[model samples]
Target: MKTKITLLMFALLCVSTLANAQKKQKALSFISGKISIAKYHEREELNRMNKGELLDLYIERIEVIVNILPNIAFATNSNVTMSTLGIPDTKENRKALVENKEASDVYFENTIEFQKKILPYSDTSDLIAAILFYESTLKSLHTYNDFKSN
Candidate 1:
């Protein structure tokens, strides 16, 4: 009876741990998907900017800046800026900017003061990765838009 009780407790513990792990995995997946979608929008904005879409340029620039603002914030130790105006500092605000939307009147403005501090230590590969991320983001955004419009 003692041995059986011990085994049962062990099993319960294992199950609990597994359940927590699964929950964590789901959260990570959700965050990753959000980030991927944001990256996609930024890439599309970049392409649009390159195609001489002047009107879109302002918004696209904001989107790219917003998409990369987190990394920039970490790198530069500055506040994260928004791509839109009048948006509050919340996860929803960030999501909106990353997803499909136009300009926001309120932006979380931050100075790019850290550029000079970190640019010297930046790696060529990192730059390449950034480009790749932008491209991927663009592809994903286009695909999503096509799916939605169709």
Candidate 2:
């Protein structure tokens, strides 16, 4: 009887751990999808967003780009920032919004304006991934005009 109970408990633990891992993986995938989608948002779609929403989308794009920078330390620091934005408050799943919108309004507006001046290019390009070429080729094409103009 004791052996059977122990086996059952162990099996249950394994199943629960697997479920948690799948949940985490799904969350990461969701984050990645958001980043990908933000990069390709059409001008009309972006224009539809209120200033706050647009700012939030712009910040999300910048944060992911920063995470993959050359410096290892930058990647680590950006991971923490990404987690803060992506992860829900520990208390409950219902209240998941991590951003303090009111507190960030001033910074968001200024940052968006500054970014536009610096980048000065539309991020909404129709050139998505090409199956025949390398991924970098697609990336190059996407930013080619911007680099040339600069």
Candidate 3:
């Protein structure tokens, strides 16, 4: 009887662990999809919005993604990337938040510098600003993974 109870508890633990892992995997894929959409807009050459309008739209889009990442519990060894996350880069995923697109690179350097300062504060705006400046956040995450492996 003791042996049977131990086996049953072990099996249940394994099942729950697998379920949690699956959820994290789904979140990772969703992050990849958002990154792809952001990249698509960044490449648009003909957007006609003025500067203020463009900045507001960029912030709105990035804030949503930043808010999502912290809720997820990723494994220490998990590798983040578009390919590894397996989220398809599709026009269907493109979300145009503004009439005119602005390049994040215009303030990318400044964004990084500001992020470092506000990181200790753990404010929402700081997190969003850090992620917004990445040329490709997914790619940068992958590069971090590579750095870790080395």
Count of residue pairs whose backbone atoms collide, per candidate = 9, 0, 0
Q: Give per-residue CA lDDT, model 1, range 6-91, as digits (tens).
A: 99999999999999876622111111112222333344444434322322233343445454434432222123244223335466
Model 1 lDDT, residue 12, Cα: 100
Each candidate structure's TM-score, on Cα atoms with residue i matched to residue i, is 0.28, 0.26, 0.27
* Ten-residue stretch with the least lDDT total in model 1: 25-34
lDDT of 2 by residue, 72-144 (tens): 2212232333344565524343223223322244454676578667543434332111111223332453454
**Candidate 3 collision pairs:** none
Ranking by lDDT: 3, 2, 1
lDDT of 3: 0.43
Q: Give the TM-score of candidate 1.
A: 0.28
Model 3 CA deviation exceeding 4 Å by range: 1-36, 40-48, 68-132, 136-139
Predicted candidate 3 versus true structure: per-residue lDDT over 1-150, tens digit per residue: 999999999999999999987663322332222333334234333144444444445554454445334423332232443344454533333222111112333344456467446544554454344434543553455455465544
The deviation in Å at residue 116 for candidate 1 is: 3.8
The lDDT values for all models are 0.41, 0.42, 0.43
What CA root-mean-square deviation does each model show from the true structure? 17.1, 14.1, 15.7
Candidate 1 collision pairs? 39-137, 40-137, 44-138, 84-104, 85-104, 85-105, 85-106, 86-105, 86-106
Instruction: Give the clash count for model 1.
Output: 9
